[model samples]
Target: MTTFDDRENAFENKFARDEEFQFKVTARRNKLVGLWAAEKMGLTPEEADAYAKSVVQADFEEAGDEDVIRKLLGDITSAGVETDDAAIRAALDAKLVEARRQFIEEA
Candidate 1:
């Protein structure tokens, strides 16, 4: 193969690896969020597991961390649970800010 073709292949592989790594990290974060949401909502273990999986699945649709966090908060409220929205909001907002900072640093 030409040198240009080899370079293109290498770039493609790097891009794919980067995407896969990001996906795994995002999934792990979503799982933790799910567990937290369930605890906040006073859900049982089975319910918490299911809820976490659902949260991660929803996030798989390209929703960013902040968006997922907001939605999870809303979901807890919609379930008629007495959760501290202000606390959750603050936590999510702080996390969002950190994520942005990390992205900037990486860039």
Candidate 2:
């Protein structure tokens, strides 16, 4: 193969790996936010775990984080938790940082 072809292949592989890493990080962040919301809603430990998984799955409903945030806001408010969109967004941002740190540590 030509040198150009080899470099192209390497770039493609790096892009794929980076995308996969980002997906994992986002899912981990979703789970962390889910656990945080569950605690705010006073869920049991088992329920919290399940809720976290559900939050991770919620991401599939849309392209961005809006779907997960909507679900959490609805559920939290329905459970009588006093919170707002800004608060949830803040938590999501914080959880994302934490999630990235956790993944980096694992790597």
Candidate 3:
């Protein structure tokens, strides 16, 4: 039987070995993180999608999550989003969890 941990570790090993998959995972997860970030800051869906694009772009630029986050906050600041990082990150984590739930249900 394939245990969850075994599957996760296999993926981890594959990630370390496969540049293409690494890029794909980075792009996908960063976009998801960006969507989470945007909703956390209460952006409209359009703005959130824009933020997700930005996050993916940032990842393409080889920036870390913190840099992507900093960029996101900067954009939100320029756009006048009011929530602080703690609130936004927390809301994002919650939203991400909910989104995953919805996605799994849909699947």
What digit string (tens of lDDT, one per residue) describes model 2 on residues 1-107?
A: 69999999999999999999999999999999999999999999999999999999999998999999999999999999899999999999999999999999998
Model 1, backbone clash pairs (residues 3+ apart or across chains), number: 0
List all candidate RMSDs to the true structure. Answer: 5.5, 0.7, 6.8
Order the candidates by lDDT, highest first: 2, 1, 3
Q: What is the lDDT of candidate 3?
A: 0.68
TM per candidate comes to 0.66, 0.98, 0.51
What overall lDDT goes with each candidate model? 0.73, 0.98, 0.68
State how far residue 7 of model 3 sits from its true place (Å).
25
Q: Rate residue 95 of model 3 by lDDT.
A: 47
RMSD of 2: 0.7
- Order of the predicted models by TM-score, top scorer first: 2, 1, 3
**Residue 22 in model 2: lDDT:** 97
**lDDT tens string, model 3, 10-51?**
999887868764455556666777776677578899988987
Query: What alpha-carbon RMSD in Å does predicted model 1 have with respect to the real structure?
Result: 5.5
Clashes of 2: 0
Off by over 4 Å in 2: none
Candidate 1 error regions (>4 Å): 61-67, 79-107
